[model samples]
Target: MGSPVGLWVCLWHLSLLLLSWVGSAASGDCKGQRTVLRTFPGFVSDGPGNYSVNGNCEWLIEAPNSNYRVLLRFLFMDTECTYDYLFVYDGDSYSDRLLASLSGSSLPPTLEATSGKVPRTGHG
Candidate 1:
């Protein structure tokens, strides 16, 4: 068996490595990160280019006008539908309305906000 001091040193190093990894994942450069939004006319994505790997990100489109609804357009989309997806909600929260779930190589149709009279604004 390893000596007690050696084992302790290994555990300490492992713990530090884990902490840094968690921090990096939480870093701005990581994918599938979490965020909350209270305003509209915004955009979100899995990262810079075509999603290179499995990742996820939720988007909420909400406007305070109440009369205004969210609009969305999928300019570019090619994902592993069976393993990855992009979910859209009509309101400020996930429980609001499941607008759509986009994945695969197909481009989703243009979407206009269902409620409100404000000019349509979309994000992807």
Candidate 2:
């Protein structure tokens, strides 16, 4: 038996762990790759790992250098156009600015973003 404070602390720790698990399980960034904005040569996929699916993910990547702009090339993409779509935002967040909305089985053309250290988030 533990005191009320002790029980509350245990519950708090459990809740924290559950939150972490949900974040990983739902978004599939178990490796915490999304924890930091990408520099370059980033290979993004749905939750878990490559070919992983059934969930949503947000991939944030920034320019490789301060002087170079970001050119994103999608080598391959096969998704459900209506249900599963990849959205590119010019800025870090998705608000009043959308760079591109891609879906279906075709590869999209290369994309460029500002080089002012502005970040971009890809919601898939």
lDDT of 2 by residue, 31-111 (tens): 324434443344444433243345445555554444444566664566666766677765555673676787677776676
lDDT of 1 by residue, 37-80 (tens): 33433344344444444444433333455544445655456566
C-alpha RMSD in Å of predicted model 1 compared with the true structure: 19.9
Winning model by TM-score: 2
Q: In terms of TM-score, how similar is model 2 to the real structure? A: 0.56
Stretches off by above 4 angstroms in model 2 are 1-35, 47-54, 64-67, 115-124
- Specify the poorest-scoring 10-residue window by lDDT in model 2: 8-17
Supply the global lDDT for candidate 1. 0.41
Runs in model 1 deviating more than 4 A are 1-33, 36-42, 50-54, 115-124
Score every model by TM-score: 0.52, 0.56
lDDT of each: 0.41, 0.45
The TM-score, computed over Cα atoms with residue i paired to residue i, of candidate 1 is 0.52
